[model samples]
Target: MKTLRFVASVSFGKDSLAMLHLLLEQRRSLDEVVFYDTGAEFDCIYRERDRILPLLEERHIKYTELHPAEPFFYQMFAHPVHSRKTGGVHKHGYGWCGGSCRWGTTYKNLAIAKHLRGYQEKVVQYVGIAADEKNRIGDKCYPLLDYNMTERECLAYCYEQGHEWLEDGVRLYDVLDRVSCWCCRNKNRKELKAIHDNLPRYWERLEALEAVLGNMKGKPLNEVVSCS
Candidate 1:
């Protein structure tokens, strides 16, 4: 049998970070550490990601940055816009995610798996959904659920060494409980308002997106960006 490659999927979230720590603590080797940059995440997420990168390198782990064929906006939204007047790069063939317009996490993982499979013989992926987040768990989950790490513990472990979740964690955490792609329609009014309050430029970007896309359904495209 081919040796199974261990790959950890991190989104710069508490659970994923904790999962990585658990793997390291057990001395399990990681063939790859992947972060999918949809280019839609909040600025803080990228900042937090920068801080996490060096730490991984310090441990001799070389991380991978993955991107979809196009930026998240083009693939997820603009391409699917029904009207020609919208004016954005898009194709009219397969149906898009639609409505929610939230980029799928499954797609992100699939991208990593597909890219690695071309070069590697076998791959075993480690997902970071915490034990407490049962709703987020599904098949091929090898990190948090298998190891039984809870969300609370994930947060605690990531913060244990101080320096703000190993540095810069607190900066985003102080402003947002859990940073995600700032434009996710799942974000609540509070989160949208927070974006306006904290990052005015980003708020303007969302407003511009709204102008181009118009109502996602009942509200502007930006309204439903996330659940938060």
Candidate 2:
């Protein structure tokens, strides 16, 4: 019988690196490694991925990049710029997403599913939950857990694999434990504070987004955390 095809879901994070390493170590051939480009991610994530692209080529791994039809801003603000209310028009407003909202993930994953539709082989999606984060693990295979690897091991693997790419100056996990969109409501107090400290303008921009939306208490993402 033919072997199953593996598809690793990567976020350019520690756990992602560990899982991919394990897969390759197992002599498993990957059908593809998919990275969902949310377009709202930190710049460093892209930089790290760019650094590793050459390695993927050297390894002859098929790396795929997928993105939703609309970026985060456009997805959040679905209405047209032109409006009778504003006379001229506004480029942005709001539609339906916040910290509690999983709509953005849903849309992105559904787009990926469209790509996954044609595969004939049994495909396994590799997720990057660390063994320590087993609670978050569900039906998906947590390679870290399967390999008995912890988050620390994942970090070490990435650093060893690409120390130059994994620079201390701009590692996302250094500032934020979890990297997501800049304006995600899911960001905790520390992450928000990190945004304010390292990327003050971005934080201001997020606040500006809130200023335009005008529904902080009434909604999820409209409220900016007190970075003070």
Candidate 3:
């Protein structure tokens, strides 16, 4: 019989980080930790990874970073797409990932899933969903929910352990609800306004992409933002 290998997937978000922390605290048999990089994540996400690397090394846990074969801009701006409806090829890449076209997430998931297939042992995947998010909990093992941890409690626990998402001297969780991809269209107006106000460099990149893409969520980027 093949041995079971426990692998944890972490996005470095509060819930994921807390789940890893709990796994460590409980002395769970974690063989590996996988992180999928979209290549468009916020600087803070990378910083958090740096903070956690030493700990993973100390614990002798295998740390694997998976990335899409194509860069984010290439996939979003240059990749060719077939148009069966028009019977013609669309020269431009898929626009901002929102509504029904979340190509970015699709790419991330495919990369992670493909990497997981390489394991010879039976893989037991661990997700970071919290107890509060029962709707998102599927068949995957969620250590956070198993421990009865809520999102707020997870964030608090991460802060207690000196883990934070900070960019430009600004605490990200203080402003945006999520600290994932800076260019994700799922971000709401409030989150966009926060980015425009706090992170000008990233905001500039957003503006440049918007210039090429023309609009975000069916309206012009500036019009969609229109921050006062």
Give the candidate number with the greatest lDDT.
3
Candidate 1: worst 10 consecutive residues by lDDT? 161-170
TM-score for each prediction? 0.75, 0.79, 0.95
Error of 1 at 152 (Å): 3.0
- Please give the TM-score that candidate 3 achieves against the real structure: 0.95
Q: Residue 93 in candidate 2 has what lDDT? A: 41
Per-residue alpha-carbon lDDT of candidate 3 for residues 45-155, written as tens digits (9 for 90 to 100) = 888999999999999999999988988889888888888899687677888876588998888888888988898998999999999899997777988877899989999
Give me the displacement of residue 197 in model 1, in angstroms: 3.4
**Total residue pair clashes for candidate 2:** 0
Query: Any residue pairs clashing in model 2, and if so which?
Result: none
- Among these predictions, the greatest TM-score belongs to 3
Cα-based lDDT at residue 32, candidate 3? 93
For residues 1-228, what per-residue lDDT tens digits would candidate 1 score against the true structure?
Answer: 787777788887777878887888887878778898877776656666787777788888869999877666566544454457677635542222333543455567678877777764577778888887788656665677777778767777877734252222225555655666666655556666666566767778777766755553456545444543
lDDT of 3: 0.88
